[model samples]
Target chain A: MAKTIITLGREYCTGGRYIAKDVARALGIKLYDKELITMAAKNSGLSEEAVAASEKRHTHSLLYSLYTMGNDLPLGDQVFILQSRIIKQLADEGPCVIVGRCGDYVLRDRKDVLRIFVYAPKGWRLAYGKENNMLQAKDEKGIKDEIDKTDRNRASYYNYYTQNRWGDAHNYDLAINATLGHDACVKMILAAAEAKEKAMEG
Target chain B: MAKTIITLGREYCTGGRYIAKDVARALGIKLYDKELITMAAKNSGLSEEAVAASEKRHTHSLLYSLYTMGNDLPLGDQVFILQSRIIKQLADEGPCVIVGRCGDYVLRDRKDVLRIFVYAPKGWRLAYGKENNMLQAKDEKGIKDEIDKTDRNRASYYNYYTQNRWGDAHNYDLAINATLGHDACVKMILAAAEAKEKAMEG
Candidate 1:
């Protein structure tokens, strides 16, 4: 079988990272999430923290340039370019599962690429956050606010960087609600991957 | 409390109809599915069978017009217009769960409308079909071809009548994979509805 890359974009607290891990393990492929930031940081000669922070919401290019004025590279553009190059390199290397950093757009021209978006309903996300020690919400309002803010950042970052809409199903080969549980989401994605492979063969 | 209309579009044999029924019952609201055709048929002065047949694949306006040439009303258009009006009327009346027939597009302008698309992995849909006596595929290939043909027709009908893509997450407030089972799908949608309502309130 030819190499196929799976790019996953996920909502906050959706266990998307965890699910991607399982998919990579099951498919026996490399999983790139935070690792992409590290690789990009190394390639760009910048700190990983700087690249990661650049992904947060409302971090405009002006503020980033002011911080790294002497470096002569806008943090946002630097991160995106380096990450895009790394994603393409990874895809060319072999089959892999890449999580976020607009991997979908980076590999958009590749027919062997499968783009997926993972999201969970608000309540489920809140519960998952609390149980996993990923977030602290005193009440439903707190939970809602945290999710809204994080989702806003993610969506803004995605929309700013990519031509396609962040969570639109038309932009993805598959969009799964991980509220269905990680295992089921994994199975469905695997099935989709298989179907996609078969389609290529035919 | 303001009325909220839940519009559901589903892939064939995904048990979307069953999920919508459970959601309506849980929320104590009216459910509209095939009954829309009956209502549209009565309102359009056409037989329910004719309206239903018009929904089938390859049943183009040209073919339909030949069957009812003297009437001068294409069956597809007649059904769409009447069904759209009925959907809007039902939304205005009160909170309800509407399944298929482009209910999402008909009620697109309403703030209280929650549009959802339900889909399932091929394996799950095939199993559900065999178990529920909805399909009698001799093998996976048969099952796959049947699903592809049915999905193509539904997509065409949806794209023809609606401004939005049928299963796009951007068009719908939520999209789900009923491979998680009917109860889970209902619960997720209910949660989503509650969250949407709360968001509107704030």
Candidate 2:
């Protein structure tokens, strides 16, 4: 039987990375998260900071450069292309759980891929961020602003790169609310993966 | 333990009704689909045909009349209001599985409700329609048109009534691809509902 690759897209502070890690550990497969950026940097012979900075740049500026510039690709585009290549290469290597970086779009043609998106209600996400001390803002309003900004950036980045809208259920095999808890989320993904594999075999 | 109300929103030809029936059967709960229309019609003292017609009317015409009309409620709005009342009453009675007719929006305030959206790829849905002889049109193009129209109407109705966008992952507890097979979908929903119950208890 062929390996099933799982591509996960998530809203910030949804414990998505933790879920990804757990799923990978349970399946005994490679997990790619921030590691993709490092891989892309090595593949492109650029500094890791440069590749990471490209991702952090506002998408509006990236779009502006994409449309206005001549044949030369924008720094963001160059990094995205490199990362996409790396994602495909890793998927070709074996079954793995990849978080974010538009792995769903990059592996759209693969039959063994299960695309999942994780999100949570605003209040739940806010509370999780505060509880985990993951928020950079001190006050409630500032923390909300930070959360909203991060989500907006992620959406913009995803929208710019993929034909399908980010966070839309149609693009994924499963879109789960993270408030269900990490264990439930991981179990659901595993079950879905097994189901996908069985269906493919039949 | 309190009953968990499951509100399902699904695309055309996704076998959403069948899934609802099976889930309700497995849980030994009442399933509400077309029954809501009949209940609303009885409550409003209107003919069942009139209530059904109100739902089938194009949303654009409904919106136009809604904006133009003075104080009098449009037939569609009246039917919707009656259904909303019936839905609330049903919830008060016991746990049930309600399919479509914006049940998710109606039960949005409830703590024990699980909102699910089921969809399948276009090719899969089209094939399902043909195999089941569910499509009104004979030719492939006409069948495609029929499928598109039904989905469009459902989305328009949902978008018009709810604050959230239709088929958006954020609005649903789980948005699953029906291609995963009905059994897998059912099991995942049951698992999620169990997880939700445990979380609430905690």
Candidate 3:
């Protein structure tokens, strides 16, 4: 069987991490999520916390660009470049499910990769967050604001680094609403992966 | 079986219309495509040609909006509202497939409807258009431009009326790349529809 790499891009509270775990386990393949941060820390001299912090500091501001001018690539760019190399390395190593970190754009030239974006309605995501105790806010509005901020940061991070928009359908082979349930979403992705493998073979 | 309404939005040359036909036929339900224009024409006392012409006129320009200010709704808006009403009427009637004319937005409040957006890489779409004799342009560049113009018009049309951005993953339940092949794409949508039905039932 040929390698089929799946890059899963997701919104903040869509149970996307859980779905990625299930998919990797189902396919008997490795999963790369936060491990990319660790790998980047190892490869670069930066500590894991620094690497993670760099990612969180959104770089979309014109003021930020001006601040970083004539300096080494901004911290976020350095982290992104390092992680992109690691993502490509992982894809080269074997079939795996990589969640987040702009894997879609890193592997854009590859024929064997299936790029997927996972999202759900805001209400559904908010409920998931509340049920999972993932919310940092005490009230519904505050929680909703947290969720939107996270999504905005993600879009900002992605937009700053890539030519493509983060959640645009054109950038992905499949963009699925996570309201479909994790099991069903997994099945659909696996089916698409199989079809993709067959297409590559033919 | 409960009714399942499928609204398909497509980029040019993605074979989305054919897939819509297949899905409708397989489900033994009616498919609404160009039939929408005829219905709108009859209900609005306009000719089908007139309605279609209005739809193609592209109402996204600021000047256009300014020109129509404090006046009757522009011809495009009038056509769109009429069609939206017809879309709601048809969905109310029974399970069916509605393609294009922003059916997704028209029936946004319905839980039973699956909003799908279909697109393909530009190369694939161009190849499909050439093979099908769907292109009016004689040169490859000309044909590519034509394809882009069509997509731009669609995005503009969709953006002009709906609060949601066209082609944003948030607006649709599923967005599939047509490179997956029509059969695979159809099967995926059917699977999603079934999952949605079961979810709704529960």
Candidate 4:
């Protein structure tokens, strides 16, 4: 069987990972989320935390030498190069669901990939965050703040990597609203995958 | 009555100008299309031909120094400055249907503006273009070719100027398939405008 790669981007606590996992299960393929952090760390010879920190963050310093006289350190450039390598390796290995890390942009030129963005309303995300203890954010206010920061970080990381705006439908093959519920999103992705396969075949 | 701005973007020869006239008549307001070209030229002090040539084309080199040099130079910059002035003037004049030149993006940040994009399929556009003589392009092939080029130019110019991609439903307040017919699009815009007013009032 041929493999299909699906990348999911979601609002904080919108259940993107769960939805992605369901889709992966339906398709009988592996799911990748935090697993990428370990893979990227191992690939780049960097600490997991360091790789995670740089994960969805853009490095914007072409003029860094102006600040450092003799240092050639480039936080952004190094992250981009290492991340590209890891992402390529994953594709080379097998088809899997990738959450965040600007995977859509990273694999833009590839012919055998499907880019998906999952989003929900702020209210839905907040409710989900509150329901689940996964959120370190304490209250509604904290949740809002955290989501905003995460969104901004994700947007910049996507824009920096792709030179295209994130969540813009033009940037992705399919943008699914997870607010319709996680199950619905999974079904949609599965259907979209089949349709994409047919499109490619035709 | 407070003044409002309605920016109409339409596919070639879609009876957009006619529908705009109807809206202006219904609301007892002014309508400007070609008049905008005149205003843009007058406000920015450029020849009509220069304004016409550069009207909806994206040169995309505002911040680049190398591209900014030449005699009678900075055509893009001049068009940019002119667009800004015309948009401001139209908004101030109030309650008008200003067509094209990416007016949607110009009024994107404004609360009092309604942005609409209208499009019809190639066959419909060609039939209308031939009957109306709105396009100088002869024959179906020529008409289709011109439509494709013009639409592309609008998208590129709109994206370049506003940093937002055109034809993305997220960017516009509303998008209309003029294939539903020009009159339907007009009615849709009017309905949308009415809803917007109710929202503002509530």
Top candidate (DockQ): 2
Alpha-carbon RMSD, each predicted model: 11.4, 2.4, 2.8, 10.9
Q: Which candidate achieves the best lDDT against the true structure?
A: 2
Better of 3 and 4 by lDDT: 3
Tens digits of per-residue lDDT for model 4, B1-202: 4256788776566777788788777778878885665575665677766566556466564444235564455565566657766776778777787887778777767777767666555676788888888887777787789988977876776766767667564454555544445544555566556655554565
lDDT of 1 at B63: 39
Error of 3 at B169 (Å): 0.8
In model 2, state the lDDT of residue B128. Answer: 89
**Which ranges of candidate 2 are over 4 A from the true structure?**
A57-70, B57-70
Better of 1 and 3 by lDDT: 3
Candidate 4 regions exceeding 4 Å error are A52-73, B1-202
Question: In angstroms, how far off is B149's CA in candidate 3?
Answer: 1.7
Q: Please give, for residues A1-202, the per-residue lDDT of candidate 2 as tens digits.
A: 3279999999999999999999999889989995664676576687756676666735544455667885687666777777888899989999999899899999999999999999998899999999998899999999999999999888888887885688999999999999988999999999899888987887
Which lDDT tens digits does candidate 1 get at residues A1-202? 4256899899999899998999889899989995765665576686767676667674444335546675676666666767778788888999999998888888988978877788876777888898898876778788789889889988888776775567877567667666445766777677666656766665
- Native interface contacts kept by each candidate, as a fraction: 0.14, 0.87, 0.72, 0.03
In model 3, what lDDT does residue B174 have? 91
Q: What is the DockQ of each candidate?
A: 0.11, 0.89, 0.80, 0.05
Residue B134, model 1: lDDT of 84
**Which pairs, if any, clash in model 1?**
none
Q: What is the TM-score of chain B alone in each candidate?
A: 0.84, 0.90, 0.89, 0.84
Ranking by lDDT: 2, 3, 1, 4
